[model samples]
Target: MKYIKEFEKKMNLGSDNQLANGHVEQASIPKENEGSVQTYVQLLKPERFYMFLEILIYCIVGHFIGYLIAPILKNYFYNNLEWY
Candidate 1:
């Protein structure tokens, strides 16, 4: 029984060491925006600036209207309120 327990413990330790090594290897590679600075900066160009801004503004406006209406409708419905 003691030998079996020791053998299992050794296998568990080996698996844990392998997982740690795998994580270390994964961390050594460049990730997302951390890799290249210029590539991310180039994404914001003059030609696409207005287009991006326009889409952003539209999304913001839609969100704002939805925010304002959602609460009011929710409250009205919960309170069973209606008007002619």
Candidate 2:
């Protein structure tokens, strides 16, 4: 029993009974940012700008495709259809 207790102590398995001998280290807490609101506002500005750019690109591409397909369809209908 004595040998088992000594073995447990050597393996640090008696942690529940042992008192801490060294200085206890603590985790450092992060400080709150005072300009966090302003930072978020700044982040949103670029997001809005990118969203506007994406919408503009979609509009331009859609109009360009429509312009290309319109003439081809018009010519096909004019040649193939017999109008009374």
Identify the candidate with maximal lDDT.
2
In candidate 2, where is summed lDDT lowest over 10 consecutive residues? Answer: 22-31
Question: Candidate 1, clashing residue pairs?
Answer: none
| Root-mean-square deviation of candidate 1 | 13.5
Candidate 2 Cα errors over 4 Å, as ranges: 1-44
Looking at candidate 2, what is the lDDT of residue 40?
Answer: 56
In the range 1-84, model 2's lDDT, one tens digit per residue, is: 798677767766544433344222432222465446664553355666999999999999999999999999999999999989
Clashes of 2: 0
Q: List the residue pairs that clash in candidate 2.
A: none
RMSD of 2: 16.4
